[model samples]
Target chain A: MLLSGDPPRGRILSAMLATIVAVLAVAPFLFPSTRALAVAERIAILIVLTASYDMLLGYTGIVSFAHTMFFGMGAYGVAIALTRFGAGWGQVVIGALAGMLLAIVVAAIVGLLSLRVRAIFFAMITLAVASFAQILASTMRDWTGGEDGLTFEVPKTLTSAFRLGGGYNGNLVTYYLIFTVAAVLFLFLLRVVNSPMGRVLQAIRENEFRAEALGLRTLWYRTLAGAIAAAAASLAGSLLALQLRYTGPDATLSFSLMVDILLIVVIGGMGTLYGAIVGATIMTMAQYYLQPAMGGLANAFSGVPLMQAVLDPDRWLLWLGLLFIAIVYFFPTGIVGRLRTP
Target chain B: MSEVLLELRGVETRVGRYQILHGVDFAARRGRVTMLLGRNGAGKTTTLRTIMGLWRAGAGSITFAGRRIEALGTPEIARLGIAYVPETMGIFSQLTVRENLLLATGRDGLASDRLDRLFALFPALRERYSVPAGVLSGGQKQMLAIGRAIIEPRSLLVVDEPTKGLAPHVIEVLIEVFRRLKQSETTILLVEQNFRMAVSVGDDVAVMDDGRIVHAGSMADLAADEALQHRLLGLSLAVHQ
Candidate 1:
């Protein structure tokens, strides 16, 4: 019912998703360490971020590099609001709203101007816009904190100093808050893709010409998709800001983060909201754990020079790349797609 | 004669440097099937695209239901009770047959009576209602394309090469489907290469050559005179049959 009639279809897929959600729900108790909590929080945030990107890339069949720019907008909105107006619930609300508004405006403008062009061209235009946003964030120094980024305090209730009774601290409360928001946003996205409007978006994705001939204004729908995706990304960014209490071009506006989002969507499966959850969890876990696991493996192989070198932690990225290639080769439709096929 | 429901007057369309439809003038009467027949590169597809506003007319006018629609967008033109099925079939292979039909309707849900009529015409669509359209055979895809066009009531239906690459039996079925549509009083403008299928369903005919309408008259006249058919189409329809 929460999926709005579009259920995750396969037995394996349903179990995998359920396991991931269950683990995240009890993550604070199951993994208690700060690093573990951080990884879980990142997974929650990335699920929202990647699912939002899927709205454009998977569902709408449009590639946009400017997703991070909107995300950075959200981060900076919260960062700047807390920095200028001071930390409070009201400030968080104002900053999040401002960020979403800005993202929607920019997304509308970019979509209207560039969506009429061919796909590759629109992608290039977004890439250029994203690069420009990055440069602007770096140069704005005073307000944006330039390349160094902005670090500020969250509301007292969300900070680590505020401790509830029963061994629960503010950090735990914050994690749950992020987790809850992510779940709601993800469900909202699922509902959207299942709706009649979502059907039109997929129709446009499959065949724009046919969709137009069918009397749907494809440009209007595409722009709406972009704006909705942007707003969602902004909210995700705001969540990231709340968790880290920091905003930076490197963290939110980096091109690498954009690439990470793309890889997550592909690994989970394109065009399915459930893919976002699966993809983001796998991708974020790998980012946090792969290096440490590789380090331990290298230590165990210390007796063999060649084996140790190959298992070096610094080469985690290479291994990650190889893993991605293997996934693509084996499950060309992506994990969810392959699971659903049979 | 039924009043003209759709008309193209001296419509000119240029695709880059090449002029595809040069002063194409034709009309589809209310409740009649107007077959636009031509050789390869005779601009039959271009004429259909122009009528649907997919391609803008460089110099001319398109009037549908007594309104100038040459300047309108494709969505606007379609919203005016005109449905177009391109030569590609445009089936949206990623979506299920039910979703494909649902997209064609203006309302939230498909009308059961209209859906029953569609299922009656193309039972394969009913059987594969929930399956993705990409799995359907060529003939079934063509059937889905036509079924999508008539999912809702429209004053005019424009389709390009519905029988292309279809089996002989499939063509017979399509001919029957067109006859049923004709009985329902839906105007159809069909661009077809199969002379047999054209003559079977077409009530009116327009012959295009070199981006122009070389001949226009009743389908009976074109079918009755082998000499005129040879003169315009460079072949006799009877010989093809």
Candidate 2:
């Protein structure tokens, strides 16, 4: 029921999903290192963020370059609230709510104003809007802390110093909080994509003209999808801010983050919500470990200058890009798509 | 006499710089099949698009069930009980055959009886119900398109070139399907290049030339007279056969 009757078909894909979920569930205990826990936390947050992006780009066929803008709204909302009102549960709740509300309103306005245009034009509009939001965040030094960004305290319960009995600590609590929320949000997205309304979204995505002829007011549905995606992305941002205890344009509103989300969506699979979990896990782990692995490889190839240079840790991004290209070439429909196909 | 279910008077439509429909006038009588016949580039498709409000009529009025609909948006016009099947067939290729019809139902879920009736009409759809529509053959896709239109009991059905590019037997199947629909008194506006199919299923006929209706009469009169057909369509039903 959580999946709304849409199951992750294929034994390989099902096994992979189960393994990822299981690993994340007990990640802190399995890999107790601070860096490892951090990687796990990042994966959790990215799952929610990428899945929200999938709601727009994959399901609704909306290509928005401003997803990071909504994400930034949430991060900045929490950061500013904590800085101004001081850290508390009440401030966190209020900030997150405000950010989601703003994201929804802005997303709706953008959708209504520009969604009637062709896809490319709408994408450009979102890009411009996102750039403007980034600039606004950077220029507003008084409230936003400017380009320097902001770091603030969370509730005492989430801090590392607060430890429970039997070696349990607030870090574990924070991780669990994020993990639980991500799981709930992920299921929520799955439910939405498999619902009757989600079917209409897919129909519109496939052919807008036919959908309208079917008596569906497509613009309204598109706007609703955009608003909902923004709300979810906003929540994801809030989680990120809570986990890192910091918020900045580069962290939440960066164009690079948007590109990362896009890559994950494509690599995992478009239009498949389950793809988000797979994509985020793979991508985040690679981002954390690939460079180190490349360094090890580079050291092994040190005897050969060309091989060493090619395998240098700094060139991890090049390898990542090549890997992405390979995945796309081999699995054009994406990993999940390839797996789902009979 | 059956009343006009849909009427277009001086409905002019422009696509960017080119005017596709110029003062087009025609009517689809209730409980009858109105065949819109034309050669290529005669604005047959454009007229159908205008009727469905896919294209805004730049001038004149389009009345459906005595309501002026030229100003309405496509969805609003569609909500008024008109189902349009475009020449492209407009099948949502990514969706399963069942999902495609499910979307058209506009309900929470598909009614079993309606689906059963659809399966009876197009048994291939039932066999491939769970398969993506993209993989279906051309004829099956056409059947799916018509099936989607009639999935629910719509008041008027507008279809464009249902027999285009299909084989003889497939065309025969479609003709039979339309005849069955005709017996049910479902008002239909059909566009076709195949005169034989038009002659077999059409009740009222409207012929378009250079973006305007050049002839409007009963299909029997047009079918019975070859000279009139040659003058209007540049070919007779016998020649097409």
TM-score against native, each model: 0.98, 0.98
Assess chain B of each prediction and give its TM-score: 0.98, 0.98
Per-residue alpha-carbon lDDT of candidate 2 for residues B120-216, written as tens digits (9 for 90 to 100):
8788899999999999999999999999999998999999999989998899999999998999999999999889989999999999999999999
Clashing pairs in 2: none
Give one digit per residue, the lDDT tens place, for model 1 in A1-342: 987988888899999999999999999999999999999999999999999999899999999999999999999999999999998999999999999999999999999999999999999999999999999999999999999999999999997789987787899989999999999999998888888889999999888988999999999999999999999999999999999999999999999999999999999999987888898988988888899999999999999999999999999999999989998899888899888753
Model 1 chain B: lowest-lDDT 10 consecutive positions: B99-108
Instruction: List each candidate's DockQ score.
Output: 0.80, 0.84
Name the runs in model 1 displaced over 4 angstroms.
none
* Candidate 2 Cα errors over 4 Å, as ranges: none
Q: Can you tell me the DockQ of model 1?
A: 0.80
Compose the digit string of candidate 2's lDDT tens values, residues A182-261: 89989988888888889989998888999999899999999999998999999999999999999988999999999999
Question: Cα deviation in Å at residue A234, candidate 2?
Answer: 0.2
lDDT tens string, model 1, B1-241? 8999998899999998988888989898999999999999999999998888888899989999999999999999999999999999989998888888989985568999999999999988899999999999999999999999999888999999999999999999999999999888889999999998889899999999999999999999999999998998888977889
